[model samples]
Target: MKTKKFQGIVQVQYEQARQSIQTGDLLFCSGTYLISELIKKASNSFMSHVAFLFEWNGRVLVFESVESAGVRIIPLSHYVTNYNNTGRKYKGALYLARHETLIDSSFDRTLLQNMIGKAIGSLNRNYDQTELIRILTRISLGVGRHKENEAYICSEFVDQCFRQIGIRFPRTEAGFVYPEHIAADPHVYPMFEIVP
Candidate 1:
């Protein structure tokens, strides 16, 4: 039997995909920072971080939790162009992905609103640095992890949002989830790499 195949990464400029980018689209980052390298090594994947997108007042915004800045939303253009407001671009590649099932189907509006509400409610909460370390340690030890319920890392935050909509990503044997896990999910497909 022939197996279903997913699309390979397509390179596209931000302006090209900007209009079509929707509320639930994903942004995956392959950062070039020290912490990014550490995460890459620990997770055994190239992608070090992940975030989701949403539109507000006709502007697309990225919603994510980072070690430096907790949960927050920033204009997608600002995020890719003047990252951290440093007048320099992000130090890595950013790719756009979509959950096929979610994007293809006509999902409930109320569910989406609830999901966005949950994410907004988490704004300014501290990034779960402890959870990140605990997850990495658990992976290293080949053991399961205990839920740290307080704050969130990028993928976990995104996972929680999807959970609000009744969609769950696959987890590791240790019951941990990472950007790589979300990237490799069968239902999610790479659309394009957003370029400068």
Candidate 2:
């Protein structure tokens, strides 16, 4: 249970037992502003259509709009287009905008904790423990990397393969640092962090 501190505000450290976290455990983390940059980057593409789709039981689900600004998920149908392209030009095309329900600090930590709890709870029913942990890790690392100050946000989409199966969440010192810790600086904005 050794914990590491970051940004003088938030600190999260995983247990050594978690090092071997199987492909069935769930990892949950959250942040803000990263999703906006993703949309901005996607808009630059010449003929790319990005949409977020939640898949369950072989069916595809697309998000209409993200609660927060600048985050979107690309539809799977877009991948069917130009199937002959082998370079995976469509890879990493979709994005998830960070969603923040709070505008100010009026809500207590319980509210924030509950938000995360609900997300995890929802995920648990849909996926196995390992898959749950992998997705959470993917998002945590994705958000951790883009923490900065310019008000610009970026979206980091976890691959569908990784989403369905289980992947390891990196257990590095840098991986544990929260986005808000680094985002405190005004000059260091619009970046991405990958854990693992």
Candidate 3:
């Protein structure tokens, strides 16, 4: 399948691109927070976080697992326009992308629905802080391996959701995944870099 290279992807303001956002679209962020920096460094990736987009009842929602909230859904508007109600947008560069297979005609819509249901079922799951630390430590020390736990980190959660629909990002030897892994998946293609 033809794909747009990340470096050549167009940048669109959220206000202008929001209406065209679709369910299953991926949202990537390179956040400016301390944890974001740490995650980026540990993952050796430009993106620190990834989330799924769903349009529910006329509102666009972002489904993400976060350190503070675990697996939760929030308005995309709130995330981009008033994150935490601070009257400021999220501190990061945001990009929008899609998994092409999810849009293919032969791909089962029922399977897509089931995958979304599975992700929604994961709501309220705790963020795997322990796994995050372990991944960081292993990456830093160049030792050890990752083991799955009950909690979910942002990329791992998104990766799991995609896996449910038969799209698996390549896993690392450490058995861990990160935002860059998801972004680099062969089935996913860059669409836009969301701008303020």
Candidate ranking (TM-score, best to worst): 3, 1, 2
lDDT of 2 at 76: 34
Pairs of residues clashing in candidate 3:
none
Residue 54: error of model 1 in Å? 0.4
Write one digit per residue (lDDT tens) for candidate 3, span 1-196: 1222565578888888887788889998888999999888878888889999988898888999999989999998876779878999889888888899966879776776866897889999999989888888888897767777667999889888888888888778878888888888887888888877
How do the residues 1-196 of candidate 2 rate in per-residue lDDT, one tens digit apiece? 1112211232222222223222211122232235334322322211112222344354333322232332333333433332124533233222222212122245243443332332333331221223223334555454322222212111112222122222222222423222232222132222121121
Q: Report RMSD for candidate 3.
A: 2.5
Give the candidate number with the greatest TM-score. Answer: 3
Winner on lDDT between 1 and 3 is: 3
Q: Over all chains combined, what TM-score does candidate 3 have?
A: 0.92
lDDT of each model, Cα atoms only?
0.83, 0.26, 0.84
| Candidate 2 C-alpha error for residue 1, in Å | 26
